[model samples]
Target: MGNTLKSVYDAKDNLKDYHVRAALQEDKGKGTTLMSWGLQDFTEKGDHYISVISGLVVRYGKGNSQIDETYIVKLSAPQVTKALRDMVAQGNKKEILFYRELLPAMNSELKKVGLNPLLTPQCLYANQDSENSVLILRDLCSRNFRKFPGKSCLDISHTRLILQELARFHSSSLLLKAAQGPQFVAKYDFLDKEWYNVTEDAIAFFITLFDGNIENGVAILKVLEGDKRTIRWLQTIKHNVYKILEEMMKERHSLHHCVARGLSGYDEYGNPIEAILLDFQIVRRASLVTDLHLLLNISVSGTDRKNNLENFLQLYYSSFKQVFDAAGLQVPFQFHELFQEYENKIMFGTLWALAVIPMIVSGGEPSEWASSHHRAASEEATGKQRESIDSKISSKHGELRARFLPIFDELIDQGIIH
Candidate 1:
């Protein structure tokens, strides 16, 4: 539980930001818990704070949840620091902005629209001076499911529900923008937020983290890094991963994909259910197709990938186009054209995943992540925080090659990846 903070910082690197000023020690109040095993990769290190893990908690609703009224609760935590106290003495905008302004604003909007299913946390509290911040919100351990990086594959039913809702959510936002105007729209803006705690320094940070192998991922990144034709493609594009998602929503071509996404009984149950969108961390504005492409590129099961590329791609396009026709929005580009663009970017995902995925695959024993913090208390820990270096190591590059190469092969066959 104590070491959880380290794991969180390891994946995110941002938590360590405020942790700089050491507060000897103070009793931080009890927090909440979210789902631990969202994805099954042994390499992916998850948030700490788990005590005991029992695989996936597949059953949805259970006892009364304590986090938020709108969504089922899972894991949560709070951090207190001496620096935070001094800041309270100084009065900082960073304090009120996150605690007072952002979350409450989102909650108010969701309530007004009568849309309560969005699992985003309602803001809890942030002390301006102490820099002490506590985010009290609902966690989605049992309710939400996570789909991780894989190539072309049939969308799983749980993920499909999320994808459909993603379209609807974007449409709703656009509709709200139409009715309320741009000023009203800015309140819900997640545009400026950082993802995976990756900021501009991430490129350099990667250099430090990978040491030797940074070149491997860099090779792919430099493909555009030097291609001044695209300007600072990775530099710019990587930063706006969230906005790019909204772009996907904007480029959405059809509602049929959303409808059909709901049709498949692809989850644990054989019945269709609304997609459960996990990880609101990267939720933001983009062309609708961007989400489709990201979802296509990042999630998807390999078994499904190998067996169903053609049909899956067909389903994605047909259903997506159906929705757009109803909305009177021309798809940004033809599906084939989109594939060509994606083919060029396939290595982007591969390279990034290469660095992280091995850690996930070899992360350690599959267990429940009982809290939102990072490391579980019961496990061994040292320094900031790190998974026990695996006894049987897994090479991240190798796993990526296995997963990505097949897709690259297909793209080559289809003449997509140039």
Candidate 2:
């Protein structure tokens, strides 16, 4: 092998111990002799930028036959800046902590209540090395898990499955807190801060990023000839963005769940039958509607969201209530209360759409927003960054308009803005 290829192979070999340990866990008490293993890049372009993801396949012999097991491994990306690397490392640390400690404890509570534990990728092995963190998880692809094919927005079938899973996840938190008391949940309060850590050094970068997103969103609005009043409302949100962000991030509710950053899984007919939530990097104590707002606005199509939002809410509530009822516990909030809270939290949805929809429609890479060292340094650099963002928005102008106009009109119809 060439020097670079040899180094990569050497690194994969070094991870053999973790692969062996994961194999033992999968094999249960049955002794299996390890035969060989291989590693391959597992992530698609634009799927992630923070970490290098690989598939680790290990072969084991049992009698005259052999079986192969696969694991999804994550390692910190080497090409990014130290600040970005540190940020990803922190996220990995939290995910490891969540899977190893908090999730099992919560699952124990679920067991007592006779509800199946929330389905997530099983962590086979993990470490939180500041620079070279590694996380090994059972490959969900073996179970037919995959992201929505292509850049298609989630349809009603897909949204239904996600809502069901999200409801169970949220309800589990409520049950756990009730059984173990707030003190149990309080032990992990540090998670709330880690979700979007804005270190003093990176504050200027985030400010620029946030401001740029809002500007692009407004630009899209004007391009679409969006309501004049709605434009004024968004401008107002931009002016008071910090306070609004703070309020949204505050611990406003008692029940907090493991809100997934994304989900993947599907059945044979190209329809979504099951979904497994991925990435527990931020399990915050926030209103359920906050998470609901994010998922609906970002992943689901605006047409689906506008037409079936109420049905979605009701599905979530019924599913949430079903778990409590099965466990002989009362739901803490009623349907009307959830509906009202969801409306009150409309700005959360608006913010998420503004921040994420443009990127999705434009096929923007994470680095464009994340590589902020230059962008935050001076007025000239900031202007260049804005110009870059404008180019991205314009490249997909038609898609952005189609994706956003429904959301903005829905907000207006609800009297949420304007």
Candidate 3:
């Protein structure tokens, strides 16, 4: 394993083969050689607050013909807190494990069953160094894959592609486990831990952040002139958040994967045709239902989620079952059981609305949660007021209100919160 980026590339025969082929297109037998390579920043400010991204651009040529290729390098941000930097390092290492070990093994199982491999960018290079960890990957953006816009609600077509991708990822785990027994996944034991290792210090931080969001939600509800009953229900939900979160994070189901965030490709008419899930930093072995709740509650618009959640579940299950059917294996659970699981997980949805939606609607960078004010707030016990939190929601009350009103209405209508 090479530590330097250039050494990694130089060691890759296939990469050289690719450049050699491209260079040879100009002249059938002319000699080809690598010319030069350089590095450049790859992401804009706020695109990724926890990690730094850059491109390693390589130029290779043969006799008047040249090709430039770029690979992305992701490293932990040096400027963040030690706690966050540690989490980032853990996530980067986990992702390296996903691409370098997990995905390849999972894809091999899928290949054995004659299914197409799960869609993911290729890992060109990876190192798991605790502080200076890095990954060099084939740049998905070069292939027209783009991050799904975070602020807007995703429509059904976009949502459909995402669910399909999720099904494939989850089913891959199932097929591999079935083929090799449950002990197979036990090797990657880190997937079974909670995403955040909740130490005593971390517990206080998580609860305070949870409370800050709960308070922000209460303010958003009041600003919307929300019904008193609904406001009270949100307050009650606040109290039970940590307990419910603990429950939700438990490993109740065997086939779990990362929370799927869309990195979509569009056709000429500008409609979504493909989705590739990204960000395996928090991959866990919890119920797949939580993935559903997280995506639908946070990523999809409240109206879209309300209108199509059942349809979305059916679509996901069918895609999931189709993989098993094609592989000549039994699906672990029936659709009715899946539906029940979704119903049982609505509390997760409510929690997402309270704790995660503000950041989405307020359009605040996730790094803001690390600000001095919020950090102070996170240290306090639950129920303490954080003016910074209130100001954030107050500044964006209209967007926050619009986003939450329908979500809360749907939750209340289903009798999940009240």
Strongest candidate by TM-score: 2
- In model 2, the worst 10-residue window by lDDT is 1-10
Better of 2 and 3 by lDDT: 2
- For each of the candidates, the C-alpha root-mean-square deviation to the true structure, in angstroms, is 12.3, 4.4, 6.6
Best-fitting candidate, scored by lDDT: 2
Between the candidate structures 1 and 2, which one is better when assessed by TM-score? 2
Find the 10 residues in a row with the least total lDDT in model 1: 19-28
- Candidate 2, residues 346-417, lDDT tens digits: the string is 777777677766656655455564343424546776567567666776666566666777778778888777
**Native-to-model Cα distance after best TM-score fit, residue 250 in candidate 3, in Å:** 2.3
Least accurate 10 contiguous residues by lDDT in model 3: 1-10
In angstroms, how far off is 331's CA in candidate 2? Answer: 0.6
lDDT head-to-head 1 vs 3, winner: 3
Give per-residue CA lDDT, model 1, range 19-116, as digits (tens). Answer: 21111011123332331222121222342222111121111222455332222211222222222223222222332353354434443444555545
Clashes of each: 61, 0, 0
- The residue-by-residue lDDT of candidate 3 on 1-418, one tens digit each, is 0011222232232233343334333333446566776556634334454455566676767678887777666665553444454555566667777777678878998898788888876666666654555666676777677777766677789889989888888888877667777677687776765434534444554565576567666766776688777788867766567887888767556545555344788777777788987667776677888888888887777778877878999999999988988889888899999988887777777776676666666555554433422255343522244445566666776666556777778767887656
Q: lDDT (CA) for every model shown? A: 0.35, 0.67, 0.66
TM-score, structure 2 vs. true: 0.85
| Cα error of candidate 2 at position 111, Å | 1.9
